[model samples]
Target: MSTSSPSNAISGASSSPSSEDVETIRKNRVLSSKLYFDISDTMVPLIYSSSYDIAFFGLEKLHPFDSSKWGRICQFLIKDGILQQSQIVEPLEASNDDLLVVIKSIFRTLCQKLNLLPKRKTYFGNLNSSSNVSKIIEVPPIALLPHWLVRQKVLYPFRKQRGWAINVGGGFHHCCADKGGGFCVYADISLCITFAFMRLDISRVMIIDLDAHQGNGHEMDFGKDRRVYTLDMYNPDIYPFDFKARAYIDQSVKVKSATSTNVYLKKLDKALEVAGICFKPELIVYNAGTDILDGDPLGELKVSPDGVASRDEKVFRFAKEKNIPLVMLTSGGYMKSSAKVIADSLTNLSNKGLIDLATPPLGTFLCVHM
Candidate 1:
């Protein structure tokens, strides 16, 4: 966050703008943007794209975070007959101004200077070069940064439709308005909620971040914002130990390392109950991360594959019971097996009648192994 004022032209955001002026700019940018478009009822709210999968010449396999997990999850769903390629909605590539609708003006210029958002070269350059893999991995794949693009695709026609969507990628809760960390280069979660607030004519939103790492990014962005209610359930001792952001959490539930599945679910049930009493949100954003699975090195918790499915079902059920519009993002989870687990959870949700989209045949049960 630079010290520059609103008058500075994409130079910096060091100074704050008057609330009324800022809102006006945000609204204007959003209204003029081409990212938001109308979709027919025939297309499924499940958002994904083949470009989301990045093959770094086998370099991605070296990184703990499975970069291709987004495409893999969709592949499994398509293979199991839960979804067809034609039914899924492919999002438009988000442009510079599209991101500026939520982020500060300076970020776009900074990204350009760093060659991070290259115009001449590929959006994502070759990672085979020295230190390139580490550099590219630091910024999440381009697929994960399309939060605003997907939000409009889902929320624009929300009133006439199911009002729920699942972006096979995103939930970059570790990135905020000013900074990016934990492999998150842009604050897509913040951008999505901000766009929803500006364009959807909605005021209240609830973020249910179940990632193993604390969602310090959004917590920081919405710390004092009463309009947003955050319910983050993450491990205490994890990558980000931001005590300041932790204080802002409306509902903070901590599960220690090696915490069993049953105990974790019980806490979530109680948390959701309390949240229902505290705030009635117009929209819910669920960040379903599988990093908490038993064997993950980063998220030291002990949840199983089955437990992950149960966790997702509980969140979907909570939303269904309230009839609130919900959006789910695959936030984190490094291992190769994370994709399979996510696919299984989708099957569970569909079987439970949570989502109206495609499901397995009556007598057939589908389980995908990566």
Candidate 2:
């Protein structure tokens, strides 16, 4: 998330304001600017909390999923530290699915409680009995950047290189098609890739996923779409273990994160070297999730901030060197507040006059800049 204080424009001097007046105005402006960042990193816990489970709490106010499901899911989610205990929505009754129906009703009542009715309505409108179950929709077609645009001219290429990156999910890389070869409404990395490709069609598009998990989602989605390429850097025994897209996998820079940063960085460096040789992509979608952070509640590997920064800097610097447009999305990380902080670091890169918002990712990262 990104936010900035309003510019202290010195308009036609009302006889130049006193120094004290200018100082006072600056202080007020600093205090009033709103805070923005990837709120999902913060709001996810609130959405999963027990307080959110109350029929009355969400009734007319929030999503209308079966209340029972919320309890069932949140228990596992919270117990695993995917969410915080303090974040639970409260004042809910104890019962099974029947009470859940009431909870759904409560969602209608709670719309005003959360101040999200309009956004929900707009979100729902996009649904026509079709949408990803995860609700990660494809970037809209109208907003799609096609090859025509990139070919016509070059605008701030530096913005593409050093700008903030927003890498979404890569571990469960399920594409928009099912394993049985049927259509799945939600798995649309292809949609994202297509949009990027159409816009930067003249340039190679790189999907560099470093989730200790796999990119099964993208593999299925873009396996046949040659315009897109993948470098699945992960372990094979990890969750979502059925990943089989390695046949076409351009750079499978896999490694085990031993109890040493040196080993981890070595693996990451190998991945980068491979990526440089195979694709030299003009755009990169980096999934810099910190589940790899040492002692991560969910991840099996061990990685530290120093290691992560090394990995991040390599990508950012490489992209800068190649002048590649990058769109980094958060894929996954179970640690508390790790994703948001990682996002904040990336946003800082944006403020350095390197990143430009082609389209802001789902977070507060661009509100200040926008």
Candidate 3:
């Protein structure tokens, strides 16, 4: 022990880097990452890919969520002529380096040779990654899927949407920096905001979460950070009742179970009003969930289909009026009708001229300030 020199002691100390070094490493990763792709003027900011659907034998039925809902929504838009296939913007999967910019730990994804449906026996030959995600993902059903597929099919798309883009499959707001839960395997919202701050030179961001349940994930991640202003409207009597995270919300509007359509819309109007007056943000992340529809069992609210459309219009109008770049995410919807409702809402937004889903379809240039 006495023979240990200064250099030897320095080497023998913790091998991990300090907090400041870790932050520098994250920034470096963000700057070098390819996930923040350039949006061409021709492409609409609507981000989605068919691969976002998670179809496995009957295994998908294990959860009430419609894993195929993302594709269904796109189908309605494309088939109904609301949008053209050429207008859609498809994003590349988030690489390990890209995800590391915000996520503390995630499985090294590697999936190959997979099939879907009744003949779909995916478990044995396809799932190559570790199944030891129980410690990270609190939901047991989510852990059943191989870590690779969760990252590839479910989580990566979320990382691509944050500011001024509509990811048809994202809004996994249940995941944070250190942990993941509620079918969310990665902190996409947090990752995107980090990229916005670091690469896009964005100073302030606003999260307008209108999901049925509280967005505990982003709340926990952005706590004590002034750059993000969160306006969360959720049912207080639902899953993820995170009291600690509630302290971080700049505005919280609680819509009780079975609340009527008009009441919900009024509450939303006031919340938007307060949000506009309180803190104006350079970007708005809209978590537009269909779970609030009347028949949605989980959402437990009585809002009609028209109400959902009205809600979307209000938010889109808010962005339009304030001239803020807004990104909408399809968060949670357990029922089969959720897809149709969301598609209808987008059609309504275009009809109102709040967003030019038809006109040459240019993105708001979220990648850079210029």
Candidate 4:
């Protein structure tokens, strides 16, 4: 058995638990966890680490997904003089205890597959079953590696960049607490929110999921919870045609395939307006996926590079106007240009004064100046 705390994972886990007990365990775990740590004054909330990139013996080439896109995004920011390498914060890995609270049942399943045999663990140190690994990433070759390596190389970066940080990777909205799929192995969004609720004195949260596909993972996890409100804009004709999850969304905006940038932005403005009136959240989680860009095989939308930048600016402005802390996750986008598109968007956010890499002057408005 793994050395991680399996008992805490099960406490108050059943369908019928007293609210007090649930709250206590959740708070206790959040308090004890190391994922939430203090950052130095010099570093910005933009979190990225070289470890975020996954590669081994050239196996990464098998998948169409750009595995090195995360690193490339940071590189572009540096090249453009918008971000400094020293200002980026490196996050601590989310230990098993930290993940168990949000992904209780699924945590056990992943561990079983990942820690298959004791001897394998000694040899590979982080071996996981290839069958299970292939399901989340959709890359067949990744399963051949040891599970420990996958966690260290792929999942750990996601765990580290959870709250108030723009993670270069993660936004696995397809995987839920009980299952994992659609290139998502862990419920990082759910985990981040849960930690915030327990540790950060935050109660209400808004999820602005602008990925091409519906964010079914977070939808499934937070659907019943009243504290979270989801604004999902996706192509209804694409993968994961989940009608059940759609019911859970607070505001659902469907943009058809090949939708122009103008049309997409117009609909987003309306959606954000409606969301503003419908709910007031303490924090905003922006799932900024670039798959909607033109020529993307999966997203099928035709949004240009400038459109993506505008979209991010709008969301940031929304949060800044409300003065709510925002956490952005670069979710799904498969094309090679996806990294450049994302980098340009971040640069746009900085240029528009929506987000600050360096410390800003007091009383400075985060919204765009008229």
**Winner by lDDT:** 4
**How should the candidates be ordered by TM-score, best one leading?**
4, 3, 1, 2
Q: Can you write out model 2's per-residue Cα lDDT over 1-370, one digit (the tens) per residue?
A: 0112222323333333344433344333323332112333233212222232223222212222122233444444444444455533222121212111112122332332234343343222232222221232222221233423321211111011111243222222443333211111223244344334433343467888776666676676566656667877776656556556766667776666454567877877777877788776666767665666676654567777657656667777777878886655444455544544454444444454354322223443321100
Q: Once superposed on the true structure, which residue ranges of model 1 sit more than 4 Å away at CA?
A: 1-19, 104-136, 139-164, 359-370
Which model, 2 or 3, shows the larger TM-score? Answer: 3
What's the best-to-worst order under lDDT?
4, 3, 1, 2
Query: What local lDDT does model 2 show for residue 110?
Result: 30
Give per-model TM-scores. 0.78, 0.49, 0.83, 0.85
lDDT (0 to 1) per candidate: 0.71, 0.44, 0.74, 0.76
Global local distance difference test of model 1: 0.71
Best by TM-score: 4
RMSD per model, one decimal: 9.1, 19.4, 8.8, 6.3
Cα deviation of 359, candidate 3, in Å: 2.5
State the number of backbone clashes in model 4: 8
**Residue-wise C-alpha lDDT for candidate 1, range 148-215, written one tens digit per residue:** 44333321221111113787777777877665567664567777777778777779999999999999
Clash tally for model 1: 3
Instruction: Give candidate 3's whole-model lDDT.
Output: 0.74
